[model samples]
Target: MTSVSSKKCNKEEYSFVYGDEAVSYEVVRKPAVEGLSHQKSQRKIAIKVHPSCEVVVIAPEDTEREDIHKAMMKRAKWIYDALKEFRGHLEHVQPKQYVSGEMQFYLGRRYVLKVVEDADALPSVKMTRGKLLVTLTRFNDGKTSMVRTLVSRWYKARAERIFHERLSELVPHATWVEGIPSFRVLPMTKQWGSCSAKGSLMLNPHLIKAPKECIDYVILHELCHIAEHNHSEKFWRLLTSVMPNWKEVKSRLDGLAELYLNE
Candidate 1:
């Protein structure tokens, strides 16, 4: 089996493999899905796994190959369990049944989606008094994915606006990072956001449901990646310099993940 090493990856930019178990753990800044990276102790490596994708491992440049492998082996059980849960989640994550008065979450608030059909009206979503009103021209018999897609798209659009506003507050000096190209909302099993060395950032729509501080923390985190591609000491030092209370926000966000990730 190939051993994990401290050698810098030229193509991957940043990666780590824990244990000599032959599992290749590589980290790549990818499109937004639904999960966050978890790291403990001294933060030598961070693991971000999407319910639908492979595990990405990030570590400092000086981490030894064998040590990284050992750490990964220690985490093997947890990784296996997480993937199992992800598979179960995929089998059951059918879109919210578009029944009348179905409960749903939007912007951290509870709202009931009341679906109505009007041939003369284009599909529209609006806050009618206090309820969310969805007017569709036709209900394609039991094609729930369409309704769910519509709702998800609506949420993503709203999230973009809210995310931009919040991110602006956190990284006022931040500029439009280029080359990293494209950001979109997708059903992610395990992360809040991602950033590419090329400069693009992918964010989760679930941020709309999280606390403002948590949202800011995620934004700051991905932005920090623009400067330091790995979870090296220098990268964290930079994060601390910018968001001193990041640890608090991180804890809160981690709790939030447990709460909403089941959906």
Candidate 2:
């Protein structure tokens, strides 16, 4: 195990501690906002990576050296890539894929796309059996930009349907949110789905590639956000009340990054 204490021990900054047996990392940092040093705990377990430019690991006090080395090696690639990519976020903000014959999602179901052109009619989407029929009666310039419009439109339709179904089943006790009005899908690289207190949700289409159980878990997770905005202890209690086996589902979902990581 490891222990961390803030002092000029070796004239170098020691901001982390790791437990060899615990398989977790703890980080130490001085409070950015002033004046709470002695009153509150300065060290905290770092379970997630910050969206910053450095690779920082925080471990519990009294952690072992061997475990700390293993943990660092386990997250070595993530640390390296995150630090490298943190500085180049501006260069990575390109539009989501709108390539022809790309698979899309509709209500957690897979859809093969079919795009058509019409000048007088606006873009519309319909699903039959296993196929997604997209009719865009507008421009056919053969440019990817023109197709992006229709693709974006299709995502909205799918997001709306899924959000409605999930809200109805998951939050039937509430009448405050009413119905989903403006939901959309995006190729979000950060999260699988997100919900707003304003009765809207943004989903990543890649969720369809996950297991059905994981999809349900994601839907239920977002639906619970309607009642609790932040992921507090109260939120977890509420989630557990609705989903007793959520831990198992979460374990499955955590490993699903490979499906969308390549995209």
| Best TM-score among the predictions, by candidate number | 1
lDDT per residue (tens digit) for residues 65-150 in model 2: 45555656666556555545554543443444555456655433556656666677766666766766666666456545656655
How well does candidate 1 score on lDDT at residue 70? 65
Poorly placed runs, candidate 2 (over 4 Å): 1-100, 116-123, 136-142, 173-189, 192-216, 222-230, 251-263
Tell how far residue 215 is off in model 2, in angstroms: 5.3
Ten contiguous residues minimizing lDDT sum, candidate 2: 15-24
How does each model score on lDDT?
A: 0.65, 0.57
Q: Write model 1 residue lDDT over 54-91, tens digit each, in one string.
A: 66776655455555566566677676666566666466
Which regions in candidate 1 have their CA more than 4 angstroms from the true location? 1-95, 173-187, 258-263
Each candidate's root-mean-square deviation in Å? 11.6, 9.6
